[model samples]
Target: MNFFTIKTSWSNAEFILIKLCMASAYILIGSCFHDFFENHYSVLIGVFIITAIWFVYQWLKKMKSHSDIPY
Candidate 1:
């Protein structure tokens, strides 16, 4: 499976499951690094903000790719 390519064949349930798993994984990672951030709230917030931006960028790219392909 291609990590950068969003599969069009996933069912609604499968898509939702994947989303939930990703979210949980992100949260788990943040928790693991909580001490590494020195418990600084601002730094933690910045990390989450960057993550959100990355997700949005990827989503937009995926949408564009899908649009360019003829179904």
Candidate 2:
């Protein structure tokens, strides 16, 4: 629980930059493997997996910060 002792805050610009960087990495990977995701089903599955991962991350973060509240 005390693994990370340093607490740092990111500005809006920093958050935006981080998101842009992550998006760029995704785009680069997608372009490099264009053939693998050419089919509609593959694209759908990729989107679903990404959405599920994001949902889980948000749920965990919320639970950690607000343990008393049930969502």
Best by lDDT: 1
CA-lDDT, candidates in order: 0.59, 0.54
Compared with the true structure, what per-residue lDDT tens digits does model 2 show for residues 22-56? 66457546756786644555555455566556655
lDDT by residue for model 1 (1-71), tens: 35566554435654553465466556657767676544565554565566666666666666677776764
- Residue 22 in model 2: lDDT: 61
- Which pairs, if any, clash in model 1? none
Model 1: runs farther than 4 Å from truth? 1-38
Q: What's the alpha carbon RMSD for model 2?
A: 10.8
lDDT of 1 at 66: 72
- TM-score per model over all chains: 0.45, 0.40
lDDT of 1 at 35: 69
